[model samples]
Target: MCCTNNCINTENPSGNCVKGYGYGKLIDGENIKYINCLEGKCFDQYILVYAENSFKAPQNSLNYSLYYFEIKCKFEREKSSVWMNIGLRNLNTNKYIYYYANNAKIYNEKDEAFNVSINWKNNDYFGCGLVYPPSNMTNKSPYVFFTQNGKEIGEEILLKDNSESYKPFVWLKSLSVEANFGNNLEAKPFKYDISDHLILK
Candidate 1:
């Protein structure tokens, strides 16, 4: 789960003030009252928040064939035109691959869009994952995948230049979102059955 200590670094592109709360919750200060401001002239800005911990594929594993990390999240905003995104960022390269919930498209760091057929609404559950295959496999390239309500969406996107580790992130405009990072599986299990893809070691 994305707790307060784990999720940090809110990057506001438009220089507007933003706040992040517990349970991976983030809220834009656009519609809220800005206290201690000079005449309250600060404009609205989009922000990107990232997790402090980065996940890496397990190495020197004899039983596990594949390594993967996933997150299940729900949009807490009301029905609107505002955009929200969830994805993973490479810790070393700082590259990103994220899913745009409103447009149902996946975008990379270069802003290239890959179309998907599904659309999501308010309070709907959606997620993204990164999978890394074993070195013995023919294709050792790592790939990213998305899900909606525990079901896979579109095809897996291969990353030829895989980074050593990645951190989960959320991009918000004017709403809030909550995420489950699979920290305590017994308390809050993941929507996707991550166990199906690999052998528990």
Candidate 2:
């Protein structure tokens, strides 16, 4: 598990600012972040952030309320086909909202995956915030938005959920990407202030 504050990756990349998750292990030592990607080897690797309730604010933990991330992916060895995913994973209800660096998609409670319209790339700033549906008195889901160099690229998409705790997740296949989880994203905070949620730092 790498802490964003002290997860100094050896042989680090130049000017590579990576965000920290509560915990991340080199998936097969192949799939890695910018710091470890320099030395780690693997074509198909995955980094997962679990929806652990114990991971909360005031500590290096994960939260479901409000989360912001700045992620950049550099193609090290481009293959004939590149498959990658950066999204929120909720296993409890077997649902997921994913971005493929080019497009975005989501899976409903019944595990039905569908495509979403989005314009994205390797380097972009992503913000996920808690949204309580006006119609739902109790149901609330997180909405994800993408930006490039401070310019909004696409419309914010509301994720479909079914009472599942979603976690920041990554899946790489012949790709290399790194993320920043607000350990340093001070100037760029979530637009709406969140009071009840926890911060993942």
Candidate with best TM-score: 1
Cα lDDT of model 1 by residue, 20-91, tens digit: 221222344212111221234433235566665767866754333433334333333344735577788887
User: What is the C-alpha lDDT profile of model 2 across 1-201, one tens digit per residue?
Assistant: 244444434333122324422223343322344333434333233334332231112222233445544445555444334445655655455566555554455443344555656654544444433333333223544455444444434445566544335566666544555555544447645333344344322
Q: Which residue runs of candidate 2 sit more than 4 Å off their true CA positions? A: 1-31, 34-65, 102-129, 132-161, 187-201
- How far residue 41's Cα lies from its native spot in candidate 1, in Å, is 7.2
State the weakest 10-residue window (summed lDDT) of model 2.
Answer: 52-61
- CA shift at 184, candidate 2, in angstroms? 2.6
Model 2 TM-score on a 0 to 1 scale: 0.49
Angstrom error of the Cα, residue 76, model 2: value is: 1.0
- Cα RMSD for predicted model 1: 7.5
- Go through the candidates in order and give each one's C-alpha lDDT: 0.60, 0.44
